[model samples]
Target: MSQDIHRITQATLDKLREEHHHLTTVGRTEIARVIEAARSLGDLSENGDYHAAKDEQGKMEARIRQIDTVIRNHEIVERDGEATEVSYASIVAVVYDG
Candidate 1:
């Protein structure tokens, strides 16, 4: 039996790409600051700040890898040129009954 990968809409893909960029840039900078602060505390072995920063770095790297994988496998959905129809990048709000 083979499992099929779920198809993601273009809007969803864009959102994911944006989030990935944010993580790669802003998130990485913040983590660097944390590590710098920890280093300024003198010793790393006994520094809680250092440990926390390292953990956060690991998580950020993991998310970056996941996002890269998704992007690599992404299939861009084609859009119809009709104004009356909703397309891949169109934002539609629908009421949900849960």
Candidate 2:
């Protein structure tokens, strides 16, 4: 299987990196604390809070993995202000009519 590379601007890449760092560090810490608090309530099977926390954790982990993949398989494209051609990270206007 071939992996597709995502084309993004340097600023966008930087933002993604920052988000990944925050999610891995602060986000993970906060989630762990929430999970621990829910776990302390006892009765894991019927713990709604615990289940919700676990679901949130799963979603967060999926996002982290997605960010990781994008960070890994991305190309930083530079933006040009005076370019006539459209390139990666270029902004375009679209018109749709019936």
Candidate 3:
């Protein structure tokens, strides 16, 4: 992952933290349960369910790592409500003549 710092809102950061918690806890447990169930289904080489569960687990772990990186490398920012110019996290809209 890039080492560049991310500027994110406190709300966004909180949401990310919540997601990280869920993935590390409930998500991991659920995937493990699925894998165990799949493992009992017979031959490992022919078990499509086992392979699919493993693949899903890998993807979830990757996302957890990504969220962890962002949570670690981010700078929390608040919107400048009084500012007259567009800035970081500012919503923008445009209109043009057709």
Which number leads on lDDT? 3
TM-score of 3: 0.90
Give the Cα error of residue 20 in candidate 2, in Å: 0.6
Q: Is 1 or 2 the stronger prediction by lDDT? A: 2
Q: Would you estimate the TM-scores of all the predictions?
A: 0.70, 0.86, 0.90
lDDT digits (tens) for residues 1-98 of candidate 2: 67799888889989999999999999999999999999999999999999999999999999999999999899878879978998876789989997
All models: lDDT? 0.84, 0.92, 0.94
Sorted by TM-score, highest first, which candidate order results? 3, 2, 1
Query: CA shift at 85, candidate 2, in angstroms?
Result: 4.1
Clashes by residue pair, model 2? none
Q: Write the per-residue lDDT of candidate 3 for residues 7-94, one digit (tens) a residue.
A: 9999999999999999999999999999999999999899999999999999999999999889889998888887789988888789
Looking at candidate 3, what is the lDDT of residue 41?
97
Q: Candidate 2 regions off by >4 Å?
A: 93-98
Q: Which candidate tops TM-score?
A: 3
Please tell me which model should have the higher lDDT, number 1 or number 3: 3
